[model samples]
Target chain A: MSVLRKSTVALVAQRAGVSVASVSRVLNNLPASESIAAKVRKAAEELGYVPDAMARSLKVGRTEQIALAVADVGNPVYVTMMHAVSEVVREAGFRLVLSSTGNDPNDVVELLDNLERGYADGVILSPLRITDEIIARLTSTRLPVVVIGSLPQGVLLDNVRADSRTGVDIAVARLKATGRKHIAFVNGPVDTVPGSARLTGYLAAMESRGLPTTADMQVEASDFTYAAGLEAAQVLTAQATPDAILCANDLLAVAVMKVITSKGLRVPEDVAIVGMDNTDLADHANPSITSVDLGSAERAREAARLLLARIEDPSRPSETTVVSPWLAERESTAEGASRGKNVKARKPELEEGVS
Target chain B: MSVLRKSTVALVAQRAGVSVASVSRVLNNLPASESIAAKVRKAAEELGYVPDAMARSLKVGRTEQIALAVADVGNPVYVTMMHAVSEVVREAGFRLVLSSTGNDPNDVVELLDNLERGYADGVILSPLRITDEIIARLTSTRLPVVVIGSLPQGVLLDNVRADSRTGVDIAVARLKATGRKHIAFVNGPVDTVPGSARLTGYLAAMESRGLPTTADMQVEASDFTYAAGLEAAQVLTAQATPDAILCANDLLAVAVMKVITSKGLRVPEDVAIVGMDNTDLADHANPSITSVDLGSAERAREAARLLLARIEDPSRPSETTVVSPWLAERESTAEGASRGKNVKARKPELEEGVS
Candidate 1:
């Protein structure tokens, strides 16, 4: 139970024996005599009265707080983005608030409603699913917002996104350079923006390289999860053994790598693998999976910068910043036996002990 | 360009042709006539007058938001805790706002100031360095807060912590049970809470096992990062090779494992390793480093639960919940040559191919 009623401006005024206007002026640091200010301050302190951030926010029109909403924080990719965004926002002298939509549609609706209610000065949202309703709501919002993912055509807003098309192209090109003619594309659900973009990019990249595109060689995971990637890869490998597999994300690539290796396949030697979103996992993997760097940290930093700009000048023309993608080659796609030999030599030491 | 000024309660009242009290009654869903409510609702809709959540929060004395302050989200351990805490907070119908103090003393001070200003209804914090000043401030906080770390003697607050002493004891015991006598303890900075506790635990466990705790076997990392771990390991190994090494965290263990293996020493056979905080990285490591499960997820969930309970009943006595720790055995502590043979056999097939 609340120990006492929350102290209000009127309560402070009553205790200070002053007018409500005088109390507000003193508390807000408006033009007030030293005596009046001291009296108000003493009264507020005595009554444990804190000028509510919310109430002051209503009068000031800015909370000095920015909200960064993402799909999930459990995913390492988003975790990195969150870290980068928080650092940038904090350095700008703004308190950062984080919210995870948890892939819930209702959470998205609630997020829009909360933003409209002025809980934050500005917002940076990375929506997993884009819908007409969300677009309509965002279009009419009074507060400045920056989206961290791809938006539909003609939906105007400040956006910072990755070049997933280029990311997938880089991964495919790396596999092709390793003399892998028969390559398979393993992707997450087609409904997701990244999933769909990477899939289309894979097909285009393969076609551009004069490589055969077969329906049998394309596999879709249920989601961007390790288990889903393993299940999907098992099905694809059972049907046909491609010389190389391009995964949509790092988690999928690592899981696919584990599956292939467990089935007695060697990376780079039997089937080369490449992942996208060059996360820490990509580097930590046994073969250190080759990955396409989509610049997650840069995307988040740019998104925070864009939102700050919009907050400062709401009338400025909206801009879209796209971070470039590049390939990071590691042992996963090494063309020699030296790297594979070392990994194999180290493997038995672990297997004999525990996992 | 500028669109228009934000609509106010007075503007809505004017448009509805009703008193401000009536407009407020209709908007707040207090007592109001159907006709008056209809008129106020129409006026609000037409003018796009979104009720200020901040102002409403002052009146209701609840923001429906919870703050979670962590040291750094970039650390995978904190990321895991954040995910669990966010899930619990969201399911409880409260918004979770994250703040990373970044190991800055001023940031922690600012956090207390912000909370005192009524930024959120409740708070759950995981402080890296717990000071007496912080404990004093928390003891008298007007808002409900739960700390996800150990508290000092006689200090009272809602707290949820992992038994790191037990966690370290289990790791050291397991190492000794596997015939490893020359044990080393590689830890982060001793100034931090986890660092000091884990260090104490290591010494106590060693003493209990009758293992000689030599100065050469004790190494302190500059920080918890992989680079620091590698540097500390390089220094420790350079002095003398320990048969087994117990790390304070997974990042250190992984880095040290790389260091040990690169030096031509086999894991378990020459130098076994055990890490604390059984994060995903532990399992993903090449020879999957054995680790201590500190139950970070459980601590977060318990902290959230305690904060909710305190919020619901502010007069209730503060409670301290401690989560137990367990050991997760992996490949770094394995025994024998049979597993190594199979890995060697798989290496040649990939080498013969294009890779």
Candidate 2:
């Protein structure tokens, strides 16, 4: 709603010599006495009074549409999440609508603000970035929101988060099992939430292996894209050849594979590759990439379940769910058990619960 | 809104000896004559009058959201369409929301019915199935709708269509140019619109080449999925081997590649393959698959534009746009000029306009 210097109907009521109800009735074009309506309108015009249009729109009858907002719609992880969330939301008798909130925290805030329009009963937000403004909006938003990623400490909300540190450790352990002595981590920008967590995981995993965990062992890409991965992998290859490389995502893994092959090196033979976010890209990859399944589908399902539960009873306590990660060992790792060997394109894996 | 025998305020007026306006005023909690208000309220209680909840929710105030409904959100084609649609709608100062209406025509009809709640100003529909019920809903919907796929001949709405026949012809002609006499067309369900049109194109191209065009030369998958393609391709290979094959979509082509390679046949050497839609899977495929670019992004952009135009002026005549298809040559076809060699992840191709 647009505001004109805090002009309100209450001010019009005072000038009109009438009650606030009379002012509201006149402003909303509801039934009013002739003299009272005329006096209210004249006073309102003098004060330049404008109602809060956004607040008015917020008044809603329960529309069954539930919104899911993600940073990048193109990411296969989100696609997996979307597919799962769609299924659960549909089963619960709510239509799922997806909103792409680009990689901007401000855009996320704006999206949350617009949700007050009440088209959707609730939203499942998987924001890549979190800002103070976003927190402010989320804290104040009347719509039920269940976040699908990490949140700042102390600001309580229903959240579903994956164990990225453990995800990286699984990738590292898988590579170590194949006797890869020189393991290097290829990461996206360390400034990002996932990027930073993954880098920390790499260091922790190396320590667990009783190997030297240094900054030099990790290379950073500008972004989590195939091109950026190629550029960063090129840099890592020039510095020193590693027997194994852990990519942050599937696209990065594909790029690293292309680079390694172009340099006359074979995957899992000369250099084993492990990818994060066991997306379809990893599944369909040639000699399929070994990746960490970070429970994208599980996270989405839990988030949707939390949202539905909260919608059923908004008084329910804010909850935080940690979905565990698993290793999807494929042909990309030497002698790895491969799901790709199956002719069926997709198989939903059985998940185990973790506290 | 729950209906109680179509009881309305008019009926309350007749029962209470009050004006319809006075009855409405009382029902809506507006100002009315004291005796008339009491009488109307009593009549309403006796009649069990209930309002239309859906109709009441249909009242909108120019909400900025525009919805795009697609059959499958997992398909890369829809992802491409969604990305393009999002950009255009955002540029027009509107938020793009996605609704995944499943493959059922009844689902699409129900979606259209629910859309009367007026959350979005307009919609861009890309339905896989065309049914009478869906057509009726589209025709009668108050929300401005633009279709992104083929509609029935007489049923008119703002429409955007791709030349699937032309897309297939280019693939067939390309294979023929490479001196491949035995060309087989691998398709999804022939009952589908694109499936039927592509099959016709294959026959026409074979006729143009003065070659036999028969059911024996073509194979049909149960559905447009990698597993289905593998099942159908296995059937095709058992009967007879074709030197070149044109697939309905990228998944099928990828599956065909796997089948051919499993039989110790090299791609573009012994069994050349071409896929349609030119999705990311085709781009990133090993020895990347040559594919028909069906202009999914273009179709979406045109669909969004048409809907926006209609929203601006409801009286504007319904329009149709035919986006032409092109070929993205890669290593899957013999002597095919490759674009996969580019290191950059994505490079949008130059588009030629078609009337």
Candidate 3:
């Protein structure tokens, strides 16, 4: 306990009769022989070497820390994106600070206040739904911020957005190619930006295909949770068992699949299931769900790059970048020759029929 | 833009010639009269009212902010626990601040330093592996901290621990009951606290059941990741298709399941699968995975209670509390009399096991 007072790796190395680098290597588990590692380990044990990270951070003028705020971290897509972001940030010599706002505009405001005081060099925010007031407050600060979603018009900022409209168009086109006329769109809350955008995209795609979307074919869930999705699916399935079902997100798609399977319905054979956000769960599901890759890794990388740029120069004119989403065909959709081809290469042809 | 600054419920109430409470009710759509609701809506539009969260946080001593620091935020179990913790904390008037250290000890030190800057009133930390130095540093601090996993021996601190030993015991017991003589235990890094604990637990459970264990039966993965689990499973499966496989965590189990399925084997029928951490994925997996419920909600509640108590009375004697884990039987485990009961009803009998 008394050894904790020094709080230096050098003191431990000196006491152990070894170089500081050797001790550090052992602590970090770097390559070293058993004998040298043994000695360094013994030295560290005797001296109680607790490294002073604060002193190092202060000296570096960079805490190697970045804050990430999301409307909900529970969403599998967001969780997958966070994992990628953390991996890249760690590789780039930075720690990740996470915050969840529960999709509440006020929660985001509270998080920003703490972010200002958290000593993080940069911040990445993924607001569930964007509002003018939230945008104004975010833009008020010159702090390095990279929004993971689109901002409202007139509020310029560094952003990495997912093109869900194109994603929905691709899903509809694939379903249409399978000769599925009646397609049901199960949505989350329409007030949410993604929900509204996906619903609008679904309607536009249906209209472009010269297909009439009956009111019964479109249903909105109270929330984005699996239970909500299941309930929405119940209503949609009751109206008419469409040959194809398109979900706004994977969670909803998963629920739809579960309900469809429970009723002894075969996917693609009885009903084609397509989900947005090709999360890990989609790959791990029973039938290996077909989904649209919203480019989570790309979004994360772009956000990190933008945040770095903003941290380097806060006064630069704000910019927004949009990443395209592509369809990932799997067992959920009907197997065909177009299944394995890269969706991006076929995007133009697919969009022509749907958009 | 000027109108946006003046947009608030108070302003709307003032303009509409109504009480602030009435404006709030109308804005919330809580059974307000058509005339008053219309008037309030028109006034709110005219004023451009948006609630100011920053001003509110400043007025309250509590920013409603709590920080959670984990070795890895990307892990599904941690993500689920965070979601549950956030839900609870939000209900109790607190927002969560998340920080990931990528399982690096140095990052933990950095997180502690930043915590002292008063960004959050309390912190919940989940270190990947505990060392003496970390325990000493954490115990020395007067700040309130609730460690999500085990701490060092003889250190009096508030703790929320998962009973991995019991979880392992149940898993092994079930496999043994299913006549799995050649049981294999796949673990992550033994140097890690969980790896070490679960390994010891597996050995102890085997010994108690009079089951012979061999060195080949115990395989260690590089890390607690999906790829590592797959690689480890390939080794374990190559030797013999063990009647049952018990994984240290759910991700490992999912990976093992994938490998087994790819090899043309069915879960439970060919190879029984059991994993710890009954995460959301467990319920949604292909066969609906069987897992151990580590009482995450209970652990969270206890951790919060202990932290608040410590904050209230730092001079009080420190304590350690262990939250028990239960076995959740799903499609992975073979259906038998043992699997008929609900998870809550059957508690794994804990025998003397090394920590």
Candidate 4:
């Protein structure tokens, strides 16, 4: 095994029989004579010495590594986002460090600590729950950070967000047009930013359509998991049999669809379902679940772009970019989709409605 | 934003009115005078100087990060393994760096480069194909690495492998017990390690069962994907209709199932199906596909544990651990499952066979 240690310009100088400044000139390709540069290069090659990325980063106060912290990796939507983020970072010549809040309860705390310790040049985080502590830490950290979800108004951090309100509106409108009076909604814990926004959007869409949303028409899952979706489905079905169900996320929707089918019910015939986040699972599921494309990949790419911009120039004004959500109509909601022509969502309308 | 810069031992010594060596002694928890230690700690607090993890790591040549490189993230089985690996690493107080070979074609080359640069403390790699170059680099890398697939014989390195041969035997025996005449095998690209192993296992299992293996009974998929599965199924069904089909992976099986059902074929009645990997996709598919549980999670956990052990003591003799595979019977293969009531596989026999 080769023992790797920091290579110094002094070693290159000694090997080349020149001063350290001459070696530096050769390394930087600055004004060194051809013979001296050739000797320095040969000596450096023989000694296997190159300016280390870590040492150069330490001197420039940049690590060239970016971290991405997410709530869970098991979630297909986050996995999609992570894939895009990794691609963007790699293209930008930076390494990516990953953290899952599922395993580490103190995600935000560790994130702040890593920032303070110069672990990475920037971070892109998708917090499950937006809290004051998060905002405060993000505000105080010297490193650049870009958030991938909703934040409090007027927060200074650069953010890439999704317009899920419009997503819920499109889903509810599609379901209502199918001649369904009782439409059920399944959400994750309301304390989360996504859950609460989806709930509000569902209620608003129902009210706009002159449909009443009773207590039995809505259920809050303990968490955003397939198991929780199954439990929530049982609770909603036992209380009132809604003609359609709108799930807050694709994982929950897949699970609920499984439960619905396992119980001898046919989708889009007995019950129509709509899920958010058009992940691959949505397309691969039997019946091919209809979902709202919350722009997971787009959001991640934008977040990486914003973070890179911020890292390049911290003095730039903080900007918030919201990717518009659209419905990906599939077999799950195909029954009600054609009731109204041109119901397919358009990015222009959503972008205008949200921002 | 508060400026983040590395604090020097000299700063701590100056604040405490002591020598730099004294400050180092206190920080290292060496036996120092009580008053001196107390003064140094207070001075460190006042100067906002905690021994930074990055600086300390540079001095000791250790970084608390482990890298995991996989072929694809779209595959649920790899996602399961990645989840398990992440959980283990987090519990051990180490961070995980993920690289997908699908996105980064130079994964092994970059791995070797990073090892020479000290990018990570250890690595857990699951190479889709093993080559002599990989073995040579692995032998020369200074960082500890654990491979999660089969290696060439007598190559000394920590390895965690899966025994898919027994898995295929169980699938075929179960299928034949139902009195099926023609059984088909749909495999992924034979160039891949798993694909090649599953194909070999299928042929051997068929010969052992006294069944005549025909050229028309086997089809090879271009890749282990749902689309590939659909395409392979079309080819398999168009030429000769088999009573049952065993797929190389769950994704392929799920896709084949979709095609069969869509074309007015009744699963387990017209044709039975089986999948390997036993991922969540299997359980959530319309018929809940029967699958071979390759012990992905167990292998990941064992790999992480082995890497940790090797990192703790590199002098220990290298060990090879094999995880046994088992069949998970579901609705897809329920036709002849009850003919013999002892179909639930026992782990003891398979474990002993592999070891």
The global C-alpha lDDT for each of the candidates, from Candidate 1 onward, is 0.78, 0.78, 0.74, 0.78
Q: For model 2, what is the alpha-carbon lDDT of residue A221?
A: 90
DockQ of the candidate models in sequence:
0.36, 0.43, 0.40, 0.38
B151 Cα displacement, candidate 1 (Å): 1.3
Best-performing candidate as measured by DockQ: 2
Chain A TM-score by candidate, in order? 0.77, 0.76, 0.77, 0.78
Q: Candidate 1: global Cα-lDDT? A: 0.78
Supply the TM-score for candidate 4: 0.79
For model 3, how does the per-residue alpha-carbon lDDT over B280-336 read when each residue is reduced to its tens digit?
Answer: 777777677889888877777777766655554455677778888888989887554
- Write candidate 4's Cα lDDT for A1-355 as tens digits: 1123224566777899876556654554445689988988888788876645423533343455788888877788888888899888877667676666663336776656754555577889998888887788889888889999999998988998899899999988877665556688999989898999999999999999897889988999999888899899999878877767999998899888988877777786667899999988888888899899999999999999888777655778999999998999999876533322212322233212211
Clashing pairs in 3: A98-B98, B7-B48, B7-B49, B7-B50, B8-B49
Q: What digit string (tens of lDDT, one per residue) describes model 4 on residues B1-355?
A: 1123224666777899876556655665545689988998888789776655423633343456778878776788987998898789777667676666662336676655654455566889898888787888887787888999999999889999999888898899988776555779999988878988999999999999997778888999999888899999999888876768999999999988888778777776667899999998898777789999999999999999888767755667888999999999998877533222212222233212211
Query: Local error of candidate 1 at A14, Å?
Result: 36
Query: Model 2: runs farther than 4 Å from truth?
Result: A1-60, A213-217, A336-355, B1-60, B213-216, B336-355
lDDT of 1 by residue, B140-174 (tens): 88889899988886778999888999999998888
True contacts kept of each: 0.58, 0.65, 0.71, 0.55
Sort every candidate by TM-score, greatest first. 4, 1, 2, 3
Which candidate number would show the highest TM-score if scored against the true structure?
4
How well is each residue in A151-194 modelled by candidate 3, as lDDT tens digits?
77777789889998989999999888766677889999999888
- Residue pair clashes in candidate 1: A1-B314, A269-B350, A348-B340, A353-B334
On TM-score, who's better, 2 or 3? Answer: 2
